[model samples]
Target chain A: MRSTKPRRWGERLIEGAIKSTGIATIVFVLLIFVFLLKDSLPLFGHAKQTASLLGTRWLPTSEPEQFGLIPLLLGSLYVTLGAMVISVPLGVACAIFIAELAPQWLRELLKPLVELLAAVPSVVFGALGVLLLGPWFAKTLHLPVGQFAALGSLLLAFMAIPTIVSVSEDALHAVPRALRAGSLALGATHWQSITRVVLPTARSGLIAAGLLGLGRAIGETMTVLMVTGNAAVIPQGLKGFILPVRTMTATIAAEMGETAHNSTHYFALFFIGLLLFLITLVVNVVAEVVVHRMGREAK
Target chain B: MSALPSAVGRTLTQTGEDGSQSAGQSVAEEAFLPTCEEVPCAPNILRPEGEIKLEARSLNMYYGSFQALRNVSMAIPERRITALIGPSGCGKSSFLRCFNRMNDMIDGFRLEGDVLLEGNDIYRRDLDLAYLRKRVGMVFQAPNPFPMSIYDNIAYGPRLHGRPDRSELDQIVEQSLRQAALWDEVKDKLRQSALGLSGGQQQRLCIARVLAVQPEVLLMDEPASALDPTATFHIEELMLQLMEHYTIVIVTHNMYQASRVSQYTGFFLMGELVEFGHTEQIFETPRDKRTDDYIRGRFG
Candidate 1:
């Protein structure tokens, strides 16, 4: 008993450390939610002002100061939808090639290279969007200004590809080898087996992958703020992709310092933050549910 | 049991080349053939019979540096059950996989000499793998049903070869399940997921899936080893019924099963075919000492 005492003490210390860290993550998320709710609650008291904030315009500095969120909401929607359109098909195809078709040596080389893409700083992507893509789009598309919603969308798509590829690749790899053998022994070609058997088996995981990528694209602020010209106009249609616009994230990031403390604008920014947090939470929860169901079905 | 031989004979003659063929020629072949009448009791000896459905000529198999089979040669007869039995790692399963070239998927697997299906070299460079597999289906030891509807599981094979219309698919599914003796239990629940079935039913569903492709031969790798006793009996009975049409090559560790179900039996030991003969002769009469020892339970 005496000899085991020191080892038992060390085990208790390590267990306590792990438990504290796990609890710390939950406590931190709750603290942020409480802070956002406390700050945003004040804006709901001014009923007329709050009602005006839902109208078409967002002229924050004009007479009486409008704060319509329609343009900002639409801008975020357009950018995220554009990014998903570009990333989902490309990322899924890349993942299939890596998981099913690549030779062993090539697979080994490509997996780490894809993971390294996530390590590149978001600021670097923002800088590239500002210095390179913005000017290129302006010149080629005949736009008056280089910074626009399309430029931000393109940069955000590039940023989201690594997440989509890695997650979906893991999903594809999770399909059992026995299913492939069964298909092949039935005289199905390799491509047929992959498309019909493996892809259907891994469907939920693939959906989870796409949703996580959407969360990443929607939450990204730096690249959109740098490239999207911060115009507070509601875009009209598909043609609005080339027009200047501002996302909710970019609006909060670009204007928070300028607003006075405890003002309507300040509380409105917090309200947008709360909305962003809720959207991200919902997407993450859905992805988690899908992944859990996939694990259960695989068994 | 008394009526089975004539019924099997009538089916064989109905599917034979022509009535104009000389009776003497067929009798010469039947001298070697083990009739269904002989299934219940041992005969003196039986020789190679009828047409050779699958032939392995001086074949050698290797996985990288280790040799799995060496200079193995055997001719499996048409419309019969041939059981390959040995202790584990005797290369029976390896030899069975060579029929459909399933070993091709293993990394560094290499084969020497030729494996022939219906007298055509299966390993020829121009041979289409899809067509070959369609003609020679496999049932693995463990049941592997796709996580789909039972109807879809049976329809998957036919859909791969051609786009069968919905009515044609339904017909094929029903016919295959009936052939596998699983139709009565699953007829109403064809749309239910195949994964919900018991282990034996899942195995039968796998067999039905393979049959939907209309293969000429079925390669069974210990097909009933994973089932309970009643399920094993059902599978053995199904194999006996199926031998009236399809040529079956089964690998088994059970000596009594080989004796009970197979018409011809081959004893394999350490990558070589030690003896091959009528199942009755191999069990009752001892030629090679190893064969005698193995059947008498002296040593594997």
Candidate 2:
């Protein structure tokens, strides 16, 4: 019992370093967020931008200083709605097919391919959307230019789908085998058990997944910039729905290059960035709440 | 002969269609309905005990290269508690699962011979496995409630078949939880999350969920094995009570439990039915030496 025990100083130092690094990373993210919020305060007080968030035009720094963001807000909403409509069914169906109905060989093959979709670079997706979907929409939908809301939304759908599929597939797979067996033991068919019991159990997780996909849909930058025509006009009709629309990320990205420091327009773009940040944060928080509710429901 | 009465003769007559009735060929139909009992040279009679609701006749099962069960033929009676008593690896649990085709989930699993329910082959391709499972509900060794409210867990089954009215769904949830002896504890918290319950409560909740489906037979695979002594005793009592409506088949390694709860006891060893008879006979004077040895703590 009196035997001497020794610990390596190097090991202690290395462990300490790893913990400090993690804490530092957390602090770094918080600092950046606070800095961004501090940088975007002017848009809230500017007379010219008074109705910017509520107004239809977005031509800032012009004779009238039209800093209204309502059209941009609508444009963002329009694209996000379209992305959700496209991604939700496709993602959940693929997840169910992979996790439940796919043949063993097919599942093994498809799972990695779907997961790989998550790792593909966002900029690459944006470039491909611009090259492929933007031109096709402009030609087919009769948009004045190639980049439009429809093209951006379709690209966002592609980006968001992998997140939904992977998360939902995990949720579906997490449902206890006993529940399925219990349903089966009670004279329920395979499809019946899956649809009735399994899906209901996975509802909360599926909601979280959908919210996360929505977050990704809103936060995407380069793709929105490439496909959204960056138009300042309020769109009219189908053309409006598919017109070159300005979005939060696109406005920030396009204006940040030419914007002058201390100028209201520069702060306006920063405010837009802040708004994007808040939207994604809200989406994530909502997702967490839904997932927690699901966990409780599972219990 | 004494345990079985001649009422089963009536069931035999029902099996004969009118085509054979006019020709007095009823005895011919009796031959097709196989049995081990001698019917006094008469045909159309139903033995009260021989009315076997479910039977595993010369059943053998294999899991890949491993032989999991060999010739595990046993009869399960209606509305009675029959406990399958055996050591681990004796295939008692596997045999229990066969009642509802739960073994279908396992890969490379094969079964032989007929598993008959009401004299119908359960393994027939045409037979709907879903319907088989519905009639033969099972509880696992561990508690596994769905990720849902205690109420929704019970309501899930009825909701699946067809849309039931709101009040009807409410009544079913209450009745099923009450049937599983958990209503008093959970009635107020019916809408609360199920995972919030304790392990034994969760197990009972699972039982309640199973009961909601209105299964005619309940197969419990060491249902109380994961519970504390008090919880175990409660489940044992619940099993006895459940036998009034649902024929209960329980697999338990506890010899005392088998004798305490079962009307009939089956002793399995090395995947074979070592002895199967009335509980008193199996406990007092088993006909087979292996059964005596097993009951006396000999090698499983």
Candidate 3:
């Protein structure tokens, strides 16, 4: 009798599918990079366009309009950093409370509620900021009562909290039970055990959580648009800061519809979009690195 | 030679806070207090050897609705090997853990009775259990070394409770290892991961680790159960040497091991003690019929 060999048809299909996915991911990333470069070709390489960022006040409708993105760049950083200042500590505390201290029933109820914050639409958060936070800060601080960077930061912080809490709670839970038991047996109190054992063990995971929140905060658009004064100028003070400071995302969203075809105003918004995509990409890489380091340390 | 079993019974009662004494009874093992009245003691059970280190009086242990020990009373003398031997589920290991209040770590564990350690009511509310455990250490049946190096394993107990001086710690670690008969074998590889040690070596390291805490009464719950024959003999030899300086209460499933290592032996059956006496008398001339049957291999 002849021996029958295996065909592995199913295995080949799986392999092909995996390879296709890998190729698709790379191609998708390449397409974004190439498109951004193609859109910004004028500023970097278009000699005939006669780009003069210094003199022009960015009236893209004029024959020779400027597309200086320095204001948008400054705006993006200001809002992202401001949001981070508010959210990092608040999010971390919320995660710790949910993971370690809250009672079972309370944590069960509270965790899902906090998670719902993440599920809420960015547009809704923007509307809430415009209706609530923007004016509230404006009145309380006695500044120009308009949408501002402060409002954008407030909305962004609220939005970022859920991602940070969910990821960090999981990180804290990932700490080994034995380590906790060992610390307790050694006569360490529960607080000490959490601080010395659990927190240290979960440090990397928490850092990853922060990085993920940062990525989301930096990429957010609508909330910043609706509440932020949407002024393209850099903020002057805390009160004026609550007025919307135009972000890279907002620049693209607000200007794209009215931007003249083949104009520097249009290309500048594309440049800002490209910058955001890179910022998010870098944030993802950092988050991955922190999480990998945590896995390595856990062993 | 003095027997000082630390942290037994009443000394650890302070841990009863947060409704743990009654509510925590689930983790409280019932196999500890067998109805000791059924067991006949050696005519000399009351013939106090030298200094009495540990004593259990009218101890009753239960697991929820199930009673594990009934009015169990026993005494362990100083610097002597007292072995509690019985078949599976006989409450030997439970009794061993009682000496160190280790059962407190188990959830729902509660003990109803007095355990005296050197004339002190160990179960009293004011007693500090963490400090008491320092004086009465334990070795578990399975070798459970902390995930650390061999040196750290031995040094952990001393380093805790304010022994921070490096040289003093080194001296304590070495002395304890020598007491456990493991200094020579592990001296060169002190920094290696304890999890990398051979089974017997790890057992000895655990012994050394417990000894470093400077416990006077050593509670071993089948220390050799997981070791090879050679390791078993070495542990037996160590026990003999240790008996000269410490009161030892060992729980073993192996009968011959009980006979060979311990001077005093007790047999437990179904939450009740069947016999306890001199090793020779219990094995050769048992007062109770159950003892005879057990020794004769009659379906223990």
Candidate 4:
């Protein structure tokens, strides 16, 4: 009885430790948000400068230092959208091939290899983008500067593909086998069954996968910073993909070290950080909700 | 041992004629017949009155090295309810799946001999699987309604074969659901998800889904096994109604269900067709001891 009591005490201590750590993680996240808000709140004291923050130009070092956010916001959007365009189709196709078409031996071989892609350091992808993809783009597209939004997008797409493939593959696999059999038994061809039934059934999860990939692409700083030429200019139309652009993440990373602490520029960088954090949080939350819906529907 | 002398003689003569050309045919005949020396071969009984819609000729099925079905042959009549009853793992469901080639999806599954549909060898290499499945539609044990609108679930099959106009789809969906006796229940909410339907309605919707494809034969693998008693009764009644138009083959574990719905019942044991005869005769006067034992609640 005494021994059991000591074991029970130990178990309670472990449980308490786990519970506190979980609460602590949430508290830390809230604290980070608070810190960001605290630093960025100083910009609101200068109403005119704060209003200029929403202007089209982002010439932070020019006379009076215009801090327009449109160029950077649009730049991030262009690169993220470009990455999604390249990765979503490729990742979904790869996932379908892995989940449905690949034989046991091939699936086992490919699944781990795809997951191994995730382990490759982001800095390595950045280095590769700078050294290889940029020069190749310059040569092929007849561009004077190879570093552009497309170059960063291509690199970010490669980074996001692993997450997209793995998550989407799991979603596809989660579709009940009975649904496939029902489709097959109803005279649908194998390809028809996959496209008509399985894909639709896993639709929400697929969306979640795409959103996760988007989040990864949007937040990627190193690769885009290295490849996008760090040009804080508003890119023009569909042609913007080939033009050098700057993402919000890249701007914050490049300027935070140079800006004087407690200055308006520094506060603007913190505000951009908060924007990035909020955008990613929203993307992740939406993805989580979609995944939960998928789970319910699967049941 | 030989109370039915006339039946035994007739069976032997029939087997002789059927087995004259093929060595494999004779082997299959011998395997089932020789073991029941005390009783007449059950297949020689008063045959059902319709033309054969599906037939398995000396069918042997194997999954890798493990045999799931031995040499088994049976004939299913057109527009009739034929029930295959056996205990778990007795190859009854496997036999049902063979009609529609549903077992083809399983890895390492190998089949010898032939399954014929309307006198055409369904197992032929060049046979269009989609067409075969269209002609021989199946309902699984659990009600599997696609997670879409009830109307879309019924329309799915018609749309797959061809691009039907929206009006044409609406017509097909209505006709199919009506035929399955489900239209009235869901007529008001055609756009509602099929997953919203009750267990019984979902099953009937599955039936309607198959019927939408306009199949000649319906293979049901314990269609009501997952439903409540009331739902099972509804399914049974629906099966009876469907028998007027579709040749139905049902695999079931419930003995009473087989006796109630099927005109012809085939009893399977350890992957062999132990006895196949009129449902009345099999339940009342089974030719083989195994069939008699199973009917009387003995070891399955």
Instruction: Give the native contact fraction of candidate 3.
Output: 0.05
Residue A42, model 3: Cα distance from true site in angstroms:
5.6
Q: Candidate 1 A-chain TM?
A: 0.95
Compared with the true structure, what per-residue lDDT tens digits does model 1 show for residues B1-300?
Answer: 122334445445433522343422332344433443532211212346678899876677899988888766777999999999988999999999999989998998999978999889999999999999999999999998998899999999999999899999999999999999999999999999999999899999999999999999999999999999988998999999999999999999999999999988888888777777677667776446788899999876
Considering every candidate listed, which one attains the maximal lDDT? 4
Q: Rate residue A74 of model 4 by lDDT.
A: 95
Q: How many clashing pairs per prediction, in order?
A: 0, 21, 31, 0
**Residue A54 Cα positional deviation in candidate 4, in Å, after optimal superposition:** 1.5
- Candidate 2 accuracy as lDDT: 0.80
The CAPRI class of candidate 1 is: medium
Give a tens-digit lDDT track for model 4, residues B24-69.
2422333233323433233543334448899786778998998998
DockQ for every model comes to: 0.65, 0.44, 0.14, 0.83
Q: Candidate 1: global Cα-lDDT?
A: 0.86
True contacts kept of each: 0.78, 0.80, 0.05, 0.90
Q: Which stretches of candidate 3 lie over 4 Å from their true place?
A: A1-43, A47-99, A141-155, A232-246, A260-263, B1-110, B115-129, B136-160, B163-300
Question: Model 1: what TM-score?
Answer: 0.89
Prediction 4 global C-alpha lDDT:
0.88
Model 3: residue A174 alpha-carbon error in angstroms: 3.3
Please name the candidate that would achieve the greatest TM-score relative to the true structure: 4
- B230-283: candidate 3 lDDT, tens digit per residue: 999999999999998888989998889999999878788776666665676677
Candidate 4 regions with alpha-carbon error over 4 angstroms: A1-7, B1-49
Model 1: residues with Cα > 4 Å off, grouped in runs: A1-9, B1-47, B297-300
Candidate with more favorable, higher TM-score: 3 or 4: 4
